[model samples]
Target: MIRTGNEYRESIRDGRQIWIDGEKVKDVTTHPMFKPVVDVRARIYDLAHEEHSRKVMTYADEETGEANAIANRLPKTQQDWKDKRAAVELVQREAGGVVTRVGDETIGEMWSLYDGQDVLNEVDPRFSENIRRHIARTIKGDPFHISANTDPKGDRSKAPQDQDPDMLLHVVKETDSGIVVRGAKYETAAAYANQAFTKPTIANWGNDKLSDYAVGFVVDLGSPGLKFISRNGFAGRAPAADYPLANRVDEVESLVVFDNVEIPWEDVLFYRHTKAAAFIRSTLHRYSALPFVQRTLHLADLMIGSALWNVKQTGLEKQQAVQEKLAQLACYREGINAHLTAAIANAEASPGGLLMPNQSLLYTGRVFALSQLPAMMHTARELCGGQICITPDSATFNDPEVSPWLEKFYTINDNWVAEDRRRLLAFARDLLNSDYAGHRLTFQLFAQSPPFAQLGAVYRNFDWSGPLDLVKDAANLSEKVNGSL
Candidate 1:
């Protein structure tokens, strides 16, 4: 069931309404802003069929006798996680840059459906079955999937009914074929992806049994009323030689307009069930958080690499102070590494018989990776020196009149020539100092919901009773403390 790169490309050329920079895109697969990212996604698909990668990227499904994407397979054992991690690392290595939302990261949310079977079953077991089918389709069809949440929620003070009801994407009408939905979601890579695990954003966990706004479904991005209005892209903004990461790996976000879009009954995962909605909001990232945090690990590596290389070039490595700063960066990197490693080693079994990373370690790792990212970037930027910002563009480096003068000033020795130094600084700039770098930092901060929600996950998963018991035993408190427990 695995597809080739060309097949993946042809699938997204389905005449979906997509706009960027005030112009309607004719074809996402061929458009300038989207071509680079789409090509990268396609290359990931093609990698599976290649000789060396087939084993790493896919596993044979016993029931169907077909090689399915390993990323989409239901994790049952610790080895499944190790395989998924290896596949993700290999894909990152092959891409030459970090690329999230390729497939594996988003597919984990479907597994979250299994975690919520009890809540969703009260809505209807049929909806739960729909989720199961979609999970299977992801493995067999190998479609590009992405998460769709975070609507343009207007006036947080006012309820959806008080303001424009469409602001939160409520059900407009129910047809025999499906329910027609009206509203939007801000998502990355939605303009080109095949489908989305569209669901409710953060909600007030009230006891309301049913509401039009509390809904979850898998939406086909190419459907008739779906419109993609993408933010301006970072690619093609400047020369790739100077802004390498942005040009090849900047994932564009879009505000997708769903104007009376029809969701066939079969595709509806949950409808008019606030309990299901609240349950989903609390556990949406249970399985997905690992891959999301793993992307930050790659960013950590890039930051450390940029800093260490800069210090090495300037002979700063010999200084004890420089070594201490570099070691701090290593600590940050290994902190994330330790969390991910321990999470897998102490993996927990889910209610549905799937293996998830240890909940406490996984969520705590997310907080560590995201909460400290800005500071880490700052440290790396400082270590890279002031040259990353002050350096001229590639055009200036190759200029006939300026080239010789720049060469004499930029060159340190035969080993550290002007060109090599310029390249490293340019890379450091794109990784830490450019517009793309800032945008990426913002994306990581809130991509899996906001910092507060991440902390909430850790709070809920962490065993508070253990600390309470320890304090009670130490202080010799009355039975009242145990009653609270």
Candidate 2:
């Protein structure tokens, strides 16, 4: 059965070991820092049950013969890719491109790909049915939020084992019921959304020395011995009133501490098989990138709309320079959308029968999107100019003394009120100047890999020479006809 938003909420109301500023959170739903994020996730659950989105958000799993979230259902054909894209768009629309973090969409897609695998038999034939059942149940009920724990090493040169062992999450002991894992997963996004889907960030090969760290499994959010440390509280600031876009769908990062946490045998997906580690990472790469492009499209739409609206409000719509700037924002949005559409159109079926985006194109898009994001934000900032920074707090307009003065000085076009114009400008400021703004810019810069590393991945994966060679041949033919002028 499809779980409702309230049901999902109740499931997580107890047993979570969440901390904000050194205090253990008694209730995540009511916590100021976590509540909005929770509300956003709850809306996703509501989408699954909505009449319009119910079909798109969920499908009948052939394995379990029950309806589950599309994120959990893997695609095996072109139609499946289309269906998955539809599901992604539905969620993106609900998020307004502002309320959900991009990582939530990306990591959720990765978890779906991971669950698509039939690795149960590979781990232990005895646990195949048990694992499959768990996977199906998880897909159907849990809106799994995944945090790719890849940045444990402060220095990039050191490997996991070479670094302080505690820097990476690893197994500490094995118990009769399960294995005890002790360590922390850092820079985890949406920690409060779904705690059960935590797994290793990289692949582990089970040599005698590394076998303890070779484990992968799912645990309850409120599992014994697990703890979460959040950087900020949700209620401390309001999104619309304070840091608009970032606060709306702010992605919270936390340290997931597993202090001898027991993960039952049935919950383990990979154990002792070093080879399967490669499979997990590769699978994630294939399925994760496309959904991000989906979310980016929504973000682009928001940026473009705001930029154009601000320009019009300022009466700069008639100015050629402003028109050109707006055009650039439009072009960027269109280009990104085109890339996403082409990637989806050209997707292929994987071995598991799930359709996945072309890795090379997806990777290229990821790099390009991140590179262009700052420029897009800059366009909005430039169009709004000093107004973004000068806009008074919403409360200022509410004050009788300041209201008349603010109205006289801040009014834009006759069609718009000074307060309305100020609100939009303030929204733009929150998006481009707030602390969250800085985090987003940094996140885009380092989301996948450093620029050089990303370029290397694109170069390694795509056949640049082949395309370049074709263009060269065409140029040579044209030169001969033109007498090398």
Candidate 3:
């Protein structure tokens, strides 16, 4: 059931509407902006079939004995999580950069829905089977799936009913086959992804059990009524040598307009059920956060390597202050490593019999990773020094007149040549100082959910009882203290 790279490419070229920078992209696989990322995604598929990666990237399904993506494998054992982590590390190594929205990260959103079958039953037992079927479809079909949650809310003060009814995606009409939804969601990689698990992002449903906005469904991105209007891409706007990461791994975000988009009955996961919507919103990132936070760990590695190499090249490693800063970066890197390791080490059993990373540790680790990201990046920026910004482009380094001057100034010693110096600075610039770097920072902050929501997850998952008991024992309080709170 695992698809090939070419097959994945052909699947997305299904006449889907995609527009960027005032021009319609003809073919995403061939477009200058999308091609690089699309090719990276394609390579991941190709990797699954390669000799060395065939085992790590894929597993034989117990029932069918068919090869399937290991990333899509339903996690039932701790070893499965270990294998998943190794597979992702292999991909990031192969890709030479980070690419988050492939398939594995978003598939967990469906697993969350699977865990919510009881909620699905409360609304409509018929749709409970929809989640199971869709989860299986993703594993067997091997589609490039993504997430859709954020809608362009018109006004925060007014309800979607009081404002433009289409502000939030809502059911516009009920057809014999399914319901037609109207509105748009901001989704990354939507233009090239095969499908999206569309749902509400609203945190509070407020007792409205049957509101129009309370709907969730599996949407085919290539549907006729779907329009993908993406923000301008970072790829191909500059020299790849100067902005390497951006050129290869910029996952373009789109405001996908669903103009009377019909959701076939089979595709609808839930309908007219506010509680169902709320349940999804709260638990949406439960399993997905593992991969999402795992990506940050890789980024930490990149930053540490870049900074350490910069210091080593400049012979600044002997300085104690510089050594301390490097140690700080290492601590940050290892902190994330510790969290990821412990999360799986203490894995928990889910209500649906699937294995889950310890929720408290996993969610708290996410907060630790994200909250410290900006500071750690700044530290890396400092360690890399100001050369990352002042360094000239590769063109000047190769220029006849400027080449000599750049070489004379940039070349440090026998170990570091001008070409090597230029490439390193360019990389550091793209990683920490460029427009793309800023965009990446912003994406990490808000992509999964906002900072406030991340904190809420920690609050909900952390066991307050243990701490309360410890305090009660320390203070010599009465046993009644247990019931007071």
Any idea how many clashes model 1 has? 0
Taking the tens digit of each residue's C-alpha lDDT, what string does model 2 give over 273-344? 554454454455556667666666777777777787887777789999998988988888877777777777
Q: What lDDT is reached at residue 148 by model 2?
A: 43
CA lDDT for candidate 3: 0.91
Q: In angstroms, how far off is 471's CA in candidate 1?
A: 2.0
**lDDT of the structure predicted as candidate 2:** 0.66
Q: Cα deviation in Å at residue 16, candidate 3?
A: 1.1
Predicted candidate 1, C-alpha RMSD: 1.2
Candidate 3 has its poorest 10 consecutive residues by lDDT at 200-209
The number of residue pairs in model 2 that clash at the backbone is 12
Note each model's CA RMSD in angstroms: 1.2, 5.1, 1.1
After superposing candidate 1 on the true structure, give the runs of residues whose Cα lies further than 4 Å from its correct spot. Answer: 204-206, 483-485
Residue 453 error for model 3, in Å? 0.5
Instruction: Compute each candidate's TM-score over C-alphas.
Output: 0.98, 0.85, 0.98
lDDT (Cα, 0-100) at 97 in candidate 1: 75
**lDDT ranking, high to low:** 3, 1, 2
| Model 3 lDDT per residue over 273-380, tens place | 898898898889889999999999999999998999999899999999999998999999888889889999999988778999999899999999989999999999
lDDT of each: 0.89, 0.66, 0.91
User: Which of 2 and 3 is the better model by lDDT?
Assistant: 3
